[model samples]
Every structure is written in structure tokens, then in C-alpha cells.
Target: MDEVEVVVAHSERTTLRVGDVFLKVDADQSRLDVEVAAMGLAPIPTPEVLWRKPPALAIAAVPGTALGVLGEPSPASPAAWAAAGAAIRELHDAPLPPWTSRSVEEIRVDLDRECEWLITNDVLPADLIRYNREIAEIALRPWTPVFTHGDLQITHVFVDGDKVTGVIDWSEASRGDAMFDLAILTLGHEEHLADVIAGYGDGADRDVIRAWWSLRSLTASRWLTEHGFDPNTPGCEFDVLRTAFEAARG
Candidate 1:
């Protein structure tokens, strides 16, 4: 019998690993629908779907390990980081998905709301929240839409040696800013930004990417806390914000 392992469980969904297969359970079927559709449309490799039953979707585990974790140093070589960047460029260049993503105004509104919540709830220092929010403002500018992996977290990308094998968790995939995807991939892994840009080619604005770092950290900290995650973990969102603050001060 394959031992069932709990991968992640939150108010919105749960993921379980049974042998080589991963099962995702979400109350919202639309997300599952999008995941299936995105994987099918994506140019890069994605996990093979084994089966789907209403609220549950089963997929064969893709080969290779995740590129890295949020709060840890990546052991992957610079070439592997570049490879992941190349894969992201390929995905961004593909046809736009049918679903539209949150507009810049929507994101700005959300950021303001989350920042207020962070201050009111004492989730973070008011000064820190204010500083990061100021930095986040630059990312509110308009951008060209692309086929983006909405939640392109470092762990979502899998690579073997220097080659990208698959990218997972496509529920958030949609027509969105390409920079947002790049920002998410390098959120806590700023050290690899140069390598990633090398493979992604030109026109990656560092200021916009850095602004997204602040925007993402500020907006996501509250949700992460509510969802049983610690944004204060070393080298994570809070740390990223602090680093930004320090850089601005000096």
C-alpha cells in the first residue's frame, strides 16, 4: 500500500501525495478546470494528468526536484536557474489564456487593503508596511499581458540538472504581466536575478521587478499568516521587505 502523505492543507484546498501520484482537492472546480486547461496549453513540460473527479484532480509526479524553496538557498547551478528563466520566457511568449487576470488597479486596491489590514492587525510594523507600500507603487504601471503562471513560486518549477522538466500549480495561470511571473520566481532568490535575466533576454526592468518584490511581500504577508504560513520566516517575504527598507535607507 502506498503511504498517503499530506503535502499541504489550508482553508481553500488540500494536496496529498500517494506514491508517485499527487492528488489535489479544491472546493472550487473552476480552478481545477483552469489548471487542466493551462497545462494542456503550456509549451513547457507539465505534470501528466492521471484522472479528475469533481473536486479532486490526480496527476503523476513530474520528474526532477523543485528549483528551490522560499526561505532557502538554491543548490541548483546558475545554468539551471537560467534554464528556468528560458522556460518562463517560452511560456510568456505563448498564446494568452482565455481568462483575464486582475487589472493593475485591482492589484493596487488589494495592496492598499492588505497594507491597512497589516497595520490594524499589528501583523507588521507600521513603518515597514508604509515603506514597502511606497516601493510597491512603482509596479502599478500598465504592462503587456502574456500567458503567465500566476503563482510561479520557486517551488512550482521543477528542474533536472540544467534542464527544466515541469512547472506545477497552474490554477493561477492567466493573461498577466510577464514581470509578475519573473518577480514571483525570484521573490526570495534575488541572488539569481542576473542568471535568470541572461536566459530571459532583454527588457527586464529591475526597478519594476524590485517594486513587485515589495508589492508581493506586502500583499501576501497577511494572507500567508491567516493561512497557517509564516511570512516572517528567514529569507522569506518579511526579510525581503526588510532588505528593501535597508537598501533605501543607505
Candidate 2:
């Protein structure tokens, strides 16, 4: 057997890949609980949980390359992106999960807190933070909660051809704003937005989706930095923030 590959190791959790199995070791039992339950509830394909032994949950690997990577152009076809959109739509249409989701007020509070930290620490300019925060506020309105993959980064989705093979990293899954998922999936991949929305078909709000994009990038940068990632890397979270800043100025 091959040695275990470190998929991701962060302050919050660690994921290891050992051949056909993925071992997720996290100290937070609640997150693990949500992952397990969400996997069971999601209508789309998800890795089957092989077994669990506290602090570590093992699941069979989903067969396929990731749909895309952050900070890089996606090699996936438009069809594949659309397929992911369709899969997401199906998942959102499913019955709401039992878990609670964040309210608009809660998200606003966190966004304000994060923006303050970014400004105080000089992580970003005050104007940039303020501008993006104002843009993000557009999304802080009431929303009907649906089953959402809270952190639907492109890397979490696996695809073979134009079909969605599986979706991984379910710890953030919950009943939440559907546009939040759409925004996360297409975070830096803006060109693919039309394709995704086309597959999603109807009731899609572009403005709200863009608002979530700004909100997600703003709130995620500090954590990503602490977790050994440089959000300032071209085409990453910080770049997304910069783009928002430029647009706001224009």
C-alpha cells in the first residue's frame, strides 16, 4: 500500500488520503456529526462513509479529479461546470436538513467582525474593507434556507467528463442561503457563472450571488492565512477582494 497523502492540514482539521480511502481527523465532533448526516441527506453523490472511530472518520474515495482549483484556471469543460450546477440545484431542492443554518443577522455580525479585524491589522486598506463590506451587505437579506454545501469550493467537487462524480468536504453543510453555495463554487471563476446559472435554471439572483462572493472572500482571508494559505496569491481570495475594491472605486 502507498503512504498516506496529506490532502489538507489546517488549524480546524486534517484530511489524509490513503489509497481508495480518505481519513478525516478533526477534533470537533459536531463538525464530524454534520458531515456524516449531511452526506446521508444530500441528494447528490457523496463519498460513502466506510467507518468512524472518534477523531477520525474514514470514507471511500470518490473517483474523479477535482472540478477545479482555487487560484488557477479550471481545466473542466463548460459542460462539467454546468453539470456541477445541475447537481447543486438537485441538492438544494432536497428536503431541508435537521441542522440549523446561519441567519442574515449572524452573517452580518461575522462579516463586520472580520472586516474590522482586516482593517485594524492592516491586512487590507480601510477603504477596501469598507467598500466590500457595503457590497456584501446586499446579500444580508432574508433567504429561504435550503440544503447548502456551506463551503462549496471548486476543489470540493469531483467530476468525470460532464457528470458530477461526487462532492466532498461536507462539514459546513447545512440549511443556508442557496446563493451562498453558488457564489462559493464560482468564487474566482466568474466566467463560468452564466453556465452554472443556466444549468441551475430560474430563480437565480446574480446580484445576491456576487454579494456572497465578496462576503466569502472577505471573511475567509484571515482563516486561510492562518491555515498556511496565502489568500493574496493571484486569482485567490485576496485577488477577489482587490477586484471588488476596484469595481467599487469605478
Candidate 3:
């Protein structure tokens, strides 16, 4: 295409926005399958599917700017955050996806592995790692699996004014803990937490959500690094981890 912009380029996938079309290129067909299925099942607004071939799926761009960016304060007003929160609540209240989510045991194993890697590489203070791990244990308990947009990063949401226009990136959508989605969306944007919770109405556990902040930061650093983004960048994942540690100590 004459005017193509690479929105995301990582080891796992590449997302290119050409004009009004978004082309996602991934080697894994199974993930594409999940994306297509999840989009079909989601109760909220999502990108329109233009077409799909192996290794690539093209979707019509939704109208509006992204809700926010990672490691940055959301430009969206509190009302936008609230609108996004309502969208998530609607999705969570829908029927569970056909696929299974990560078990607590599976998460614990990954946590242990990532924590060891972080310490071995001298990525953080050992005490910080230890404290976060202890705090993270609270989120490992059983939860009622909801239909979650597994990677609900701020960039995945589209908004016009205070209204949510669409949500994107459904590959990670599955039956999972609802708080995990909430945590992922609000990570690194702590100021918006109350806004989101206000929109969500009730029955949220802030402690568990914060625990996920620690757990996700601890586990995702390696993958993010391999994907070209530096998780250690100031005000990013490392900062999130440090924040979690301080909160636990207080």
C-alpha cells in the first residue's frame, strides 16, 4: 500500500494500518481463529472484518482516536474511561467463551519462572521481586471466568469524545478472570482507576486488580523486551512493579 503505517511490530505479530484498513500479520493461524471468533461473540463494538487469509486479517478501521497509550496518562477524559469501563462490564457479563483460560497453577508457574529470570538478570531488587510475588498470590485464587478481552491495553480501545466507538485486538479474548482485563486496561494509568471503577458500577476487587499489576509486570517484561519495547523504560512496567512494591509496604 502507498500509505501504510506499522502500528505494532513485535516478534509475535505485525499490525499495519493502510488507509482505512488494518492488516494483522501473524504466523499463528490459531490466534487468528480466536480473534475472528471472539469478534463474532463479543457483545460490544469491534472493528469490522474486511477479509481474512492465512497469516493476515484485514479489518475496517473504527472511527475515533485511541483511548490512550501505554506508559502515558490517558488523554481521554474520565467520561471516556467510564464509557470504556461500561463496555468491559457488558463484555464480561456475556456468556463465557468456548475456550479455557489460564489456570491459577499455570499463572503461578509462569510467575515463578519470570521472577527467577528477572532476579538472575539483576533487573530489579530481589526484595522488590519477593514482595510483589507475595502480593500477587492474592490474585491466584479461583475466579469466575468471564469473556475477557485478554489484552485490553489502552491502545486497543477507540473512542470519540466520551463514547467508546470500538475495541480491537481480540486474539487474546477468552474465558478468564474479569479483574485481569480491568488490571491490564488500567496499568500504568493509576489516576484513571477510580474513573474506570466508577464506570464499572460494582463487585470489583481493587486489591486483586493491583495484584495483577504486579503479576503482569513481572511476567511480561521478557516478552515485551523481545518484542522491541523496553519494559524497563521509565514510567513503564518497571515503574509499575516499583509502585506495587511501595503500595504493599505501606
lDDT over C-alpha atoms for residue 184 of model 1: 95
Question: For residues 1-250, what per-residue lDDT tens digits would candidate 3 score against the true structure?
Answer: 4698999887788999889999999989899999999999999999999999989999999989998888777789999999999999999999988998778999999999999999999989999999989888999998988999999999999999999999999999999999999999999998998988898889789999999999999999989887788987777899999988787689
> Among all windows of ten consecutive residues in candidate 3, which has the lowest summed lDDT?
226-235
**Model 1 superposed RMSD (Cα):** 0.8
TM-score of each: 0.98, 0.98, 0.97
Q: Give lDDT tens digits, candidate 2, residues 1-250.
A: 7898999998778999989999999989899999999999998999999999989999999988898898899999999999999999999999999879777788889999999999999998888888888889999998889899999999999999999999999999999999999999999999999989988988789999989888999998888888899999889888888898897678
Worst 10 residues of 2 by lDDT: 240-249
Per-residue accuracy of model 1 over 58-84 as CA lDDT, tens digit each? 999999999999999998999999999
Q: Note the clash tally of each candidate.
A: 0, 0, 0
TM-score of 2: 0.98
Poorly placed runs, candidate 1 (over 4 Å): none
lDDT of 2: 0.91
lDDT of each: 0.93, 0.91, 0.92
Q: What range of 10 consecutive residues in model 1 has the weakest lDDT sum?
A: 198-207
Where in model 2 is the C-alpha error above 4 Å? Answer: none
Model 3 ranges off by over 4 Å: none
Order of all candidates by lDDT, from best down to worst?
A: 1, 3, 2
